[model samples]
Target: MNCVLCLIENDPIAIFGLKKMLEKTNYVKQLEVYEDGEQALHKLKPHLIENTPRTPDVIFLDLNMPIMDGWEFIEAYTAIDRPQNAKKILLYVVTSSVMQRDRDRACELSAVTGYIVKPVTKDDLKHVFEEDLQELWKNQ
Candidate 1:
């Protein structure tokens, strides 16, 4: 199933590369890119609260940004009182950081689905979908 996706990142090259890769896979029906965490949180909060279909199915978040870093976003986002009927949003920490501490910290969050290193590869993308597919099939 195609999904609506959000990418919160500061680097133009990273955005372009991810956009291109997503396009090639045809897995994303919509992609919203935010330059920083504050923008994403601000823009997505309303949709999430309203339980709109426009709400992203997946979010790729970067740890480092100019304003409102990923950690801050997570704290604020988790605090939001989303409707129970709202779609399940899968959040993934996608960053250049290879630090074990970073990975451990990200994984500690219940909202976060997985963590991927920067320059996301086809294999990583495939794995994301594969996990979703497995869940979908199981439900069916």
Candidate 2:
């Protein structure tokens, strides 16, 4: 249940809503919100370097942002020397983008666990927890 949830979106309302939903959830212990991928990446580096528990367990990345979009973030993240804890980290493309190309690209990444549409609800989080997180933990 000890986990970090990262959200990178320019919209404050969306971030707030997601944070509220996460607060209602049982699984997530800690949640981290970022207005842009650049900031998230900057803070994430220290956690990766220290191999700390503050590192995110799941990253809810957005395709659009002011600086460093989800694709760019993933590229940069992949280039770094991910810590042992980071190896278990799951990246999910949580965006409003309904484009097939985006979905296809997201699915192509081995680190990405799933691609989810925007306006993520508690039910969506529940499904992700049950279907993906549970399976991942079981396998590990």
Candidate 3:
């Protein structure tokens, strides 16, 4: 299976850890990391404009960043017009913030499929890939 994964965060360590976790997973083939939401959005826009099939399959977004936070990223991502075959994109909010408001806001986004806390582990990825992802795969 072909899949694209994106990690957007200002922290390099967090990005590296998430990328490593995904690398150990069976589903992810390509992974992209961005330091901020604006950079991610800028990079993704051209791909969307070209109707690129390589657009990320899943996005792990951080609530806080130097430029354009996760909320802004969601707004931009949702506004983009993608091709029919562009990939089944799932957005997951992965952040250190434990505030209920943040969690609630993340869940409120239509594009967001799940919310995960910081220090994501292989087990978490496994559950998402094996269990939650099964429904989407079956539909596909």
Q: On residues 1-140, what C-alpha lDDT tens digit does candidate 3 reach at each position?
A: 46677778898888777767666666787778888999999988877666466577678899898869889989988998877776677789999998999899889889999999988988778777677667677888
Model 3 scores a C-alpha lDDT of 0.81
User: Which segments of candidate 3 are over 4 A away from where they belong?
Assistant: 49-53
Candidates arranged by TM-score, highest first = 1, 2, 3
Estimate the TM-score of every prediction: 0.93, 0.90, 0.88
Where is model 3 poorest over a 10-residue stretch in terms of lDDT? Answer: 48-57
RMSD of each: 1.6, 1.7, 1.8
Error of 1 at 32 (Å): 0.6
| Ranking 1 against 2 by lDDT, winner | 1
Residue 96 error, candidate 1, Å: 0.5
2 against 3, candidate with superior TM-score? 2
Number of the top candidate by TM-score?
1
Of candidates 3 and 1, the better by TM-score: 1
lDDT of 2 by residue, 1-140 (tens): 76667777788888888877777777788777787778988988887666566877778888898888888888887887865644477788899999999999899988788899988977779877767777777887
